[model samples]
Target chain A: DAMVIQNPRYQVTQFGKPVTLSCSQTLNHNVMYWYQQKSSQAPKLLFHYYDKDFNNEADTPDNFQSRRPNTSFCFLDIRSPGLGDAAMYLCATSRTARDEKLFFGSGTQLSVL
Target chain B: QQQVKQSPQSLIVQKGGISIINCAYENTAFDYFPWYQQFPGKGPALLIAIRPDVSEKKEGRFTISFNKSAKQFSLHIMDSQPGDSATYFCAPLSGSARQLTFGSGTQLTVLP
Candidate 1:
């Protein structure tokens, strides 16, 4: 089945340490997105890649960065993990950067100690 | 300001009952609305969606009621079951950017 896959279902990082979460998709979607969801809250948009162009949300912190090496792979890098950064990170893909259904991975839970 | 607002942060319903979750959006540019369901420790999956041009769309027991004039939409689960217990989020899709603005989410529990 074509779907989104995220590596390291659970991750633990020390404070100020750098951590990376990865996502891959077999859907061959042109648009990929990263979302941060805290406990009992909505998933907030961090950034997304439309084809190869990186689009960052205005409120996204500088500590968070994203990279799309190719259409099938995208990476989320946290330069300095803070305690508040601990949450579930979700990766989603869509056929286009317009109104369309999204395919999401199981998600990676980050715990900053 | 939050672009999307959802109500009734939590709800409990009996099996065979009806479950309703409501959401409102302030963005007029939003022409697409989708509802996602997420279970514990899993990512959200698309359940049902509705376009502003239509007032309602249904798939099996899941239904989406959209009101373009009111800028609101709702998800209704018919004959709710224990397996239907999960968190539901209403997200509005807007622009060529396709960035989805999600509501806070509603946690629904269906007791058997």
Candidate 2:
């Protein structure tokens, strides 16, 4: 089945330490996105890569960055993990920029101690 | 800015009952609206969706009612079961460059 996959289901990091979450997709979707979801809350868009063009949400802090090495893989990097940054980081991909149906990976649960 | 709002942050229903979730949106970027279901410790899965051109769409016990004029839509789950308990999110997509803008989410608990 064509699906999105994320590595390290649970990640623990010290405050101020940096961490990276990995994502890969077999769906070959051109648009990959990263979202932050806190407990019982909505998933907030952090940024996305539509092909090679990166689109970042205005309110997304400078601490979060993303890299799409190719069409099938994407990575999210936290320059400095903060306590408030502890949440589920979800990786999703759609067929195209106009495609709204997203396939999401099982997410990396980040814990910043 | 696009904002999706959902009501009833949490709901409790008995098996064989119907579960209803309402949503309203502001500044919708596209006509497509979808509901995602997420279980504990799992990624969200697409449950159902509707387009503005249609008033209602149904697959099995799940139904989606769309009201374009009111900028509102809803998901109706018939014959609610314990297995159906999960968090539901109302997300309208194509917003901010064709991405989903998800609502806060409603935790549904269906008791047997």
User: How close is each model in CA RMSD to the real structure?
Assistant: 1.1, 1.5
Model 2 residue runs over 4 Å out of place are B94-96
Docking verdict class for candidate 2: high
Cα lDDT tens digits, model 2, A1-113, are 63999999999999999999999999988899899999988888999988999999999999999999899889999999999999999999889888878888999999999
Q: What is the lDDT of residue B1 in candidate 2?
A: 53
- Give the candidate number with the greatest TM-score: 1
TM-scores for every predicted model: 0.97, 0.96
Evaluated at residue A24, the lDDT of candidate 1 is 97
Q: For residues A5-88, could you state the per-residue lDDT of candidate 1 as single tens digits?
A: 999999999999999999999988999999999999989999998899999999999999999999999999999999999999
For model 1, give the TM-score of chain B.
0.97
lDDT of 1 by residue, B1-112 (tens): 8889998899999999999999999999987899999998999999999888889999999999998888899999999999999999998888655777889999999999
Q: Model 2, range B1-112, lDDT digits (tens) per residue?
A: 5478898899999999999999999865667899999999788889999988899999999999999889999999999999999999998876555677788899999999
- Evaluate all candidate structures by whole-model CA lDDT and list the values in order: 0.93, 0.91
